[model samples]
Target: MKITPLALAITLICVLAVLAGTTAPAVASDAGGIVGGIFGALIGTVREGEARNDWQKVNREVKTCLSKRINVSIGQLVQKAIDPTDPRLRPYMQACEQQVAEANAQLQQERRIAGLRREQEEAAKEAAAVRNAHARAQKVARHRELIAKYGAKIASDIEARRVRIGMTKEATIAAIGKPNSREVVPPSNELWSYGTKRIAFTNGKVTYVGN
Candidate 1:
């Protein structure tokens, strides 16, 4: 008597159909035989494993409803049409109601999770934009400071690609802005490369410069 989402849907449909019938026949005595057509229609709407609609959340409450109303399985409904006055019908209806409620709760939980995920993605984007803007501002400020100290001659050296042996590391950086890479060449000697050009520093003073 597990009212799955599919079963819940079928039961809901069948209950509506039955109530609509005032004096419908209970068995397969005539062409309109019980809930057989109703079951068949539900089955036809999907393949064997898929749910017909979005009522998939009814699966969770198997403990609360299915543990008690165990015998009212899906296919058995065809053999006899439900009677409003029948002794078994009340429990079946109660179980169906519980399944519907559980399904609705599950749907709400999914929507909440989706909303939170979107909010997190938006926050991450804003943080990255702020970081990028700060970095750009810092670089611009450093360029202005370098130009103020060394004047237009250092700016021309930076633009025309030049590094001299007497320039300090900071002056070299002011001349070239920054290298693509730097490395130690043993015995406290540092080598900074800018494009194909290389500058060697020893004891914090430029020792060798070449392209």
Candidate 2:
């Protein structure tokens, strides 16, 4: 059965009371007629669905052990003046206690694994963000270096994608990016074509620009 938070809380209180010498009859009366109270409070809300399911398993297993060994239904135990510390109940209590311990341990291990998974995912996201930031910073630094070398006006022209006569071959190339093709003008010039636009370079400087 699904255990609610309030039910678990009440069970925990009852367990405390039982441990403090509360009689079996009193426990049965207050916490319902459950043998060993299923130790529901021992696990105590470790997680939501899975944890409750584990507690429910413990409850059923303990009650089953009690019913089989004592030959009495859980409901009958509540009406009888059953002693919580009865010698006949010892072996079953020990076995049921082991089950509770195992359930708690399993829940703890699952919680640790989930925490590790979350940490790994967060670390990966942080690493990717750092890489992107570094790439952007490098781009900004490269832009500044180009502006310093070519002067602001030339840089502005490059930014506007304008190629003009008297601009250095390097500067013109920077403005328009790489050309589609380059041709050797027989004597000492270079002809660079950019799709429909063409530029003529003489002695490493642009001499003419045309479509």
> Candidate 1, 22: how far from true, in Å?
35
Tens-digit lDDT track of model 1 for 1-211: 6566567557666665656565556532332444556557555543333421212333435433543575653333322432223465557656667776878888999999999999999999999999999999997776677678766667556646577676678878756778899998788789889888888999877899888
User: What residue pairs clash in candidate 2, if any at all?
Assistant: none
- Per-residue error for 186 in candidate 1, Å, reads 20
Cα RMSDs, all models: 16.0, 16.1
Residue 190's C-alpha lDDT in candidate 2? 97
Model 2 bad stretches (over 4 Å):
1-76, 81-106, 156-167, 172-181, 193-199, 206-211
Local distance difference test, each candidate: 0.64, 0.73
